[model samples]
Target: MIDFEIPADVAELRDRVRKFVDTEIVPYEKDSRVTAHGPTDELRRELIAKAKAAGLLSVQQRPEGMSHLEQAVIFEAAGWSTLGPVAMNCAAPDEGNMFLLSKVADADQAAEYLDPVVAGTTRSVFAMTEPDGAGSDPSQLSTTAVRDGGTFVINGRKWLITGAVGADTWIIMADVPGEGATLFLCHGDTPGIVIERVMNTMDRNYVEGHCVVRFEDLTLPESSVLGSVGQAFRYAQLRLAPARLTHCMRWLGAASRAQSIAIEHAKTRTSFGKPIGRHQGVGFLLAENEIALQQCRLMIWWACWHLDKGAKARHESSMVKAMVSEELFKVADRCVQVLGGIGISDETPVAAIFTDMRAFRLYDGPTEVHKYAISRQLLRDAAE
Candidate 1:
C-alpha cells in the first residue's frame, strides 16, 4: 500500500547527493573535533561552493517550489553525512527560518535577508526558546516587542538559540500586548542585542554554539515585522508542521547509517570462534533496528505526502517526530552496544550519534509535549 520508490528525476538527484556526501562530507567525519553543528564559516563557505558546483545547494527549493515528498528525499540524502545538510545549504534553523521568510517576507525583506541566506553568504537564527519558559508553549512567549515611534523595541532573554554565535540575522518571536505574539526580523548586531554565552551542548559541533541571548531594548523598524502583527503564533504553527517533518527525514538518514554500521560489525566481529551475528541475541537486535528504520521511513513518507497535498499535518508531524526520535535513539544506542568499547568511544560515529539522538527528544517540542497534543486531538475527534 505504500510506495517508497522515488521518481526517476528525484532518484537521480538522490544519487548525486549521496555521491557528494560520500566524497565531500564523510571524510570530515573522521575528525572527531569537526563538531556536528557543522563547519566554520570559511569551511562552510568552501563546502557550499562545492555543493553549488555539484548543483546540490538549495535543491530543497525548486524553481516552481518543492513537493513535500521531493523535499523529504533531498533532506534524507543530505542527512547521510552529518555535514551533508550544511554543505547542501539545507541545514536547520536556517532551513526553517527560510521557509517561514519565504512564506511571509515582503520583496524588500526577501532581498535583504532571505537572498543572502539562499546564496549561503549569511546565516540566521530563530530565537524562540526562553530561559524561564516558552519551550513547548508558544503562548507562554515572554519576550515583548513594544512599538515606539516608527520602530519596535524588543526586550527578552532567549536561551538554547541555535546558530546565534555566527548568525548575521535573527527571526525573533515575541509577545505583543493586546495583539498576541508577533515575528520580527532583527540584525544580530543591532544595538542592545547581547550574546550572553554559547552554552555547550551534548552536540558541540554546531556552527554557532547554542547561545543564550539577551535583548536589552533592541530596536527594529516597522518594516522588519514578518507577516501580520498578532499573527506570529499562526506563522510559527504553520512553519513547524513542515519543519518537524524535515527533522524526521534527516534523522532517519542518520539512523540508517548507524544501523548499517551495527550490521557490518555484527557480521564480521566474532566471538568464541564464530561471528557474533550468528547468535540470536545479536541477530535479533540487528533485526529490530532494521524494522524500526523501515517503520520510521514509512511514517515520514506518509507525513510528507500529506504535506504535499497542502494538508496541515500537525498531528501527523507530531506523531512522526515522537516516533522517529525514540526509534533513532534506540537504534543509535544499539549500535554503540554492538560495537562494544569502540562504539562508546569516539573511534566511531555511534557514540556521537547516540548523544545527538538524545537531544532530539528535547528539542522541537519534546516527546511528552507531542504525546499530550496527540491525545488532546484524539479526544476532541472522538467527542465530535
Candidate 2:
C-alpha cells in the first residue's frame, strides 16, 4: 500500500515555510521594487536576507541529502507567494543550476561558481534557449565553442535567459564542432558575455525577468567545462527531469493561493439573495478547484517519490509536468472567473497567478511536447 502520510519532520518544515511565506514574503507583493521586468537584485537580496535569518536559505542547496518528495512539500510552501520561492532561494534557474552543479561540478568549480549561489549570496542564469529555433528543441542549438589552443572561444546568442540582468554566475550551453553540445560554467562578468536587454514576459515571478544575451568570443579555460565534454545533453536530462517536477510543485502552491482567494471572495460576495458561493455556478467551480488541486498534489508526490527512490523518473516527470501545468492553469482560470471583475484587476494576485499559470503551460517543455514524448514512449513499448 502507498503511504499517504507526510513524515512529522517534513510536515513541520512545510508549516514553517508556509508561515514564512505568508508573514514575511506576501507583504512584498505590492513593493515597488518589483518592476514590470521582474524583481531587482537589490529587492532579491533583501528578500534572501529575510529567508537567511529565518534559517531557510540552504535546505535546497544540499541536493544530495535532501529527499525529492520532501522538496515537493517545501517548494510548494515556498511557492505560496510567487516571491516565496525567491525569498527562500529555491527559485528556478538558480535551483536547477544548483542541481546541475551538484551533479557535475568538481571541487574548484563548485567553490567558485556554485557554493555562493547555493548560499543565496548570488544569482545565476542558465543560457540554453536561443533566439532562433532552439527554445524547446535543444538540438537546434547553433551556439559554437571553438577550441583555441588552451581555451575555448564561444560565440552565440541566448535569449529568454532568466536572471541574466544582474546575475553573478552563468551556465552556458554551446556546441563543440566534433564533440557535440556541452555545458560551460562561467562568471557573469566574464569577458565577451553581454546582457543585451531584458525581455518583457507575461510572468514576473523571476528576479531579473527574461533576458537576451550574446556571447562575443567569450573565452574560458578547458576547466570551464562542466563534467566531461559531449555529456551536456545527458546531464541536461538529469537536471531537467527533477527541475521540471519542482516547477509543478511550486505552481501548484500558487494555484492553491489563487483558489483560496477566490473561495473567500465567493464566501463574502453576495449575488441574488445570499453569498455567491451558494449559487451552484460558483460552488461548482470551488469544488472543481479542490479536486484539481488534489490531483496536482498527488501527481507531484507520485513523481517525486520515484525520484527519491533513485528512479530517473523522466517519463513520470514529463507526465506530471504536462498534466499539472495544464490542470493548475484551469484552476487559476476558474478562480479568476469566480472572482469576476476583481479577478481582472490587481485587487488580488489571482490575475497575476492566472497569467503565470498560462506561461507555465508553455515552459518546461510545453504540454504538447510532453504529450508527444509520452505517446512516443508508449509506442516504443508497444513496438518492443
Candidate 3:
C-alpha cells in the first residue's frame, strides 16, 4: 500500500516554501526585466541567498531515513512558488545534474563541481540534447571527446541548453575514445568553449539563460571524467527519470495557479446575465481541469515514491511524463480559454503558463518518445 500523507516536518517545510514564494517571487513576476530566461545574475544571487536563509536550498537531500514521498511533497510545494525551484536551488537541469554527480563523482570531483552547485555558489548546465539529433535518442549523440596526453579534448555544438549563458561549468555529453558515450566536466572559460547565443524561449523565467553552445577544442584534465568511462549513457538515463518527474511536480504547481486564476475570473466575470462560471460549458471545462490536475499529482507522487524505494521506475516514470505533460497543457489551455483575450496578454501569467506547458511537452523526452518507450516495455513484458 502507498501512503501519500506527508509527515509533519515535511508539511512545515512546504508551508515555509509557499510563504517564501509569495513574499519573494510573486511580486517579481510582473517586473518587465525578469524574462523567461529567469532572473539576472544579481537577482539570482539575492534570491538564492534569501532562499538559503529560509532553509529552502537543497531540500531534496533529505535526512538518511526520510521517504521519497516526503521529498516529493516538499518539491511540489517549492514548485508552488513561480521561482521557488530555482531560488531554492532544486530546479532542473541543475537538480538532476547535481543528483547525478553526487551519485557518481568521487570526493575531489564532488568538491570541485557538485558541492559548489549544492551550495548555490555556481550554476551548471547539462550538454545533452543536440540540434538535429540526440534529443530523444541517446545513441545518436555526435559530440566527440578525444583523450590527449593528460587531458580530454572536446569538440561539438550543444543547443537548447538551459543555463548555458552564465553556467560556471558544464556536465557535457560526448563520445569517448573506444567508449560508446561519456560525460566530462569542463569549466566555462576553458579554451575553445564558446557560447554561441542565448536562445529566446517562450517562457522567460528560467535563470542562467538557455543557449546554443559551440565547443571548438575544449580541453580538460582526465579528472574531469564523471563516473565510469562509457557508462555515461546509463547515467544519463538514470538522471532523466527523476528529473522529468520533478518537472511534472513543478509544472503542476504552475498549472494550479493558472486554474486558480481561471476560477476567480469565472466567478466574477459575467456574461448574458450571470457569471460565466454558471454556464455549463465553462463550469465543465473547469471541472475537467481540476480532475486532470489531481490525477497528474497522484501519478507524480507515485513515481517519486517508487524512486525513493530504489526502484528503476522506467515504465512508471515514462507514464507520468506522458500523462502529466498532456494534462498540464490541457489545464493551461483551458485557463487561456476561460480568461478570453486577457489570458493571452502579458497582463497575466496564463499566457506564459500556456507557452511553458507546450515546451514541457518537448523537453525531458517528448510525449511521443515516452509513449514509444512505454509501449516497448509493455511488449517486452508480454513476450517474457
lDDT of each: 0.84, 0.91, 0.84
Compared with the true structure, model 2 gives a TM-score of: 0.99
How does candidate 3 fare on TM-score? Answer: 0.96
Worst lDDT 10-window in candidate 1: 30-39
TM-scores for every predicted model: 0.97, 0.99, 0.96
Error of 3 at 60 (Å): 1.4
- Cα TM-score of candidate 1: 0.97
- Residue-level lDDT of model 2, residues 1-384, one tens digit each, is 999899998899999999999999999999999888778989999999999999898677654577888999999999999999999999998899998898899999999998999888899988999989677789998999999999999999999999898788889999999999999988988999988888989998899799899999999999999998888889999999999998998999999999999989999999899999999999999999999999999999999989988899989999998999999999999999999999999999999999988989987799989999899999999999
Which scores greater on TM-score, model 1 or model 2? Answer: 2
Candidate 1 lDDT over residue span 297-357, tens digit each: 8888999888888889999999999998898899888888888889989777778778878
Candidate 3, 289-357: lDDT as tens digits: 999999998998888778977998989999999999999999999999999999999778889889878
